[model samples]
Target: MSQHVFLRGMVAIRLFSALAELTGALLMWRFQRLETAVRINGLLGLVGPLVLTTTMALGLAGLAQSRLPAARLVWIGAGVGLILWGTRR
Candidate 1:
């Protein structure tokens, strides 16, 4: 309902998505010595600079655009969807 909500949604979606991707990659590829739960927990730590850059880019592009390529309502709906999807519990 507020810009702050969108901002928080963006942060949550970006962070969780990146962490899930990285953790899945590591667990699926390297980190053979690590436990599956440990590999999953690796995502709980923090992301590096690269993912941060990507997150910033996505937020800026999505929020800063005066008129996004898609309808504003569509974007808002997508953002809501992302937030809902990331926090089902």
Candidate 2:
């Protein structure tokens, strides 16, 4: 029973992750083919970087959760830095 519950939780996480990915893809597609000097592409560009950073942060957080609690903060900080850098560039 315990194993089943764990598996169910994992499945739920995977499902939600996939949904998030799909949503991001659709949003990107919606902005694709738009000419330059437009707001949509600029906004969509921000989304890609933010999503990438967030995914990295989530992975880092999960790994840090297993290894060291203190290290999690470092990972989060790095993720935030990356997002900020990406958005600027």
Candidate 3:
């Protein structure tokens, strides 16, 4: 509905796709089953939450982007924090 929403959706989709790839790779490496229905399902399972979070984050960001600059800054800050947290973990 908004630019922020669109961007967030794009980010979520990108993240989900990335996780799917990772899951597929992991399954193939660990199970020796690359072309199975179960592996595809497993990938989708991992991707589902990512898609939801992406949508939620974008929606909140979109709502906040119009009302306050602080909201936007907080979103950016959260993203940076996530990156840092990810790297550290």
Candidate 4:
């Protein structure tokens, strides 16, 4: 509803994204049993980015009608893109 709320949401989203990635990596490393492997990998592979894109879209949408800070927006955009890019492969 407010910029403060959206900013906090973005921070939480970023933090959760990092944690999801870490969890995924840990699971991938520690477990190799066939049955749960795909489930874990699949969950890790798809869910994190889904949440990420959702949050990024929300963050962008929240500022869409407002005049965004150009420099900060660029930096934030780049950082988010970088994270997505790094995690993609």
Candidate 1: segments with Cα more than 4 A from true spot: 31-89
Greater-TM-score candidate between 1 and 2? 2
Per-residue lDDT tens digits for candidate 2, residues 4-85, read 4444555566566567667666766776754632554465565655555555556555555556577667867777787688
TM-score leader: 4
Q: Pick the candidate with the highest lDDT.
A: 4
Residue 30 of model 3 has an lDDT of 80
How many residue pairs of model 1 clash at the backbone? Answer: 0
- Alpha carbon lDDT of residue 82, candidate 3? 80
lDDT of 3: 0.66
Scored against the true structure, residue 72 in model 3 reaches a CA lDDT of 74
* Between candidates 1 and 4, the lDDT winner: 4
The runs of at least 3 residues in candidate 4 whose Cα sits more than 4 Å from the true structure, single-residue gaps closed, are 32-39, 65-89
Residues 1-89 of candidate 4: C-alpha lDDT, one tens digit per residue:
67777778888888897898788777866886766777877877787777777788778767753778777777877888899999776
Compute the lDDT of residue 35 as modeled in candidate 1: 76
Error of 1 at 41 (Å): 18
Which pairs of residues collide in model 3?
none
Worst 10 residues of 4 by lDDT: 61-70
lDDT of 3 by residue, 1-89 (tens): 56755676768677767777786767667876646757576667666555655665665567565676776767875875586567552
